[model samples]
Target: MQKQDTGKKLTVSLIVLALTVLAAIITRLTGLETTSAKLIGSFAAVFLLTGVVWRFPFRFYCMAFGFEVLAAVLGSALNLYHYLGFYDKFVHYTSGIVLAEGGLILIHALAGRRHTPAEPLLCRLFSMFFAIAGAGIWEIYEFTADNLLGINMQGDNTNTMGDIISGTLGALTWFGIHTLMHKRQQEKQ
Candidate 1:
């Protein structure tokens, strides 16, 4: 199983790398140097994350890489965010879900290390807060980028608030679903 997972990881990593190169080409053709650079940087970050979480399930890496492709490639490089006003919100919502998953993974890892089961309530709280904190940190990044780099990453106050709200709602949705799943799993045991 581990060997199979390793092969799968290699395949997925190659696909992502190829997509990143394609996105870079498209952005470069459109003269969007900044967007191209950002996309490549995003790919690098995702690759690093894969190395860091190599022991985790492939699905988690897929989730993170999928977000990078959606947000960096399709959204920015393809300029989908500008054409589709809701795309940004959708991305933010997905980010929340991803962050929530990250939180769950972390909790599970810690529990395994301690040779104990994760507490249900603690897991839920961690997931929710991890997503919420991630949202906050993202907003801060946008703000800082906009202010320091003279880039309009955050748009106006309304857009920023909407992003935060959307992310929070996503986290809530994930929490509800995860709770139900956990309950079902426990009942089965």
Candidate 2:
């Protein structure tokens, strides 16, 4: 049953990724240079990361992979960030949650499945740290692109700070929910 579920998830993730790539191609063919560049860059990065994550032995990686691809498609190809003022914040926040989940999976996998929900503090901390680090690295990427490629990824310090804060909050929210869920499950068990 678990293997079947994992296969379904992987299939869905791959489909989403394919759609994202198609969006990038369409944009490029349409001569939307800026949007096409953004889409292609985001798609490439996610594709590479997904390739690495594929080697991992956890189902959560599929969830994170799908979310990241969808976020990139919405932001770059669909222009959600420009059309909806809050879309960027939404993406950043969800990204934090996804990253945190990935971190927790990594910790569990590295620990050889010895860790349990009963002892989750370390995993939670690692998740939060991972999310924050991801946000910081993303900011650096934005800054670099804005300066070197003249892209308006960062816009300004204010936007950068806001994005970081939003991401952190998202991580916190996910941690809280995860803890509660685990606690409930433990009680039931």
Candidate 3:
């Protein structure tokens, strides 16, 4: 692949680094509550991860990093806002995250390289495998974060199932998206 003028990459990474540092400074100065601190910390992680993409353009990593940063920012916002008496509850956060994560996983899977691996049926299977596996690994991370850190990410068992199901739906959504993109690509040829 031709080397991209990743001065933009460096610039973006620097912006994230600055944001991470700024979040640290603002939190220290404001002396916010526990939730606020956690949220800021989440953003810090997001920025730091994004800042590292200067090394390579691995599509999965890039998408994962970007999605995760967004997830942290929005997730932390949900916790802080709801607890600060803005919303009635924090449950909405989990659902929104599940949907969003699923979408990200699908986008990631579709964007990845597809080597003509097998027959049409097998190709479909392989495609689904990557999408499902990617989404499932993310869910596994959520489980680990919940069980190990006491975060109640899944909420209820039923809700957890729903989230998993929704994630699969998100993968399906990506299939549609990728199909359209592939069609456009073929048309250009």
Name the best candidate (by lDDT).
1
Clashing pairs for model 2 are: none
Q: Please give the range of 10 consecutive residues that has the lowest summed lDDT in model 3.
A: 86-95
Each model's TM-score? 0.85, 0.78, 0.57
Per-residue C-alpha lDDT of model 3 across residues 27-78, encoded as one tens digit per residue: 5676644366665677667657655544544453445444544445433533
Give one digit per residue, the lDDT tens place, for model 2 in 1-189: 357666865675577778787777766676543455677667785667666666554556666666666577767776667778898888889888888887887777767666544348888888888888899899999999899998688977889999998889888988899889879988999
RMSD of each predicted structure: 2.6, 3.5, 6.1
| Residue-level error in angstroms, candidate 2, position 106 | 2.3
For model 3, the stretches where C-alpha displacement exceeds 4 angstroms are: 1-5, 18-40, 47-65, 77-128
Q: What is the lDDT of residue 37 in candidate 1?
A: 60
Model 2, global lDDT: 0.76
* Candidate 1's TM-score: 0.85
Candidate 2 steric clashes: 0
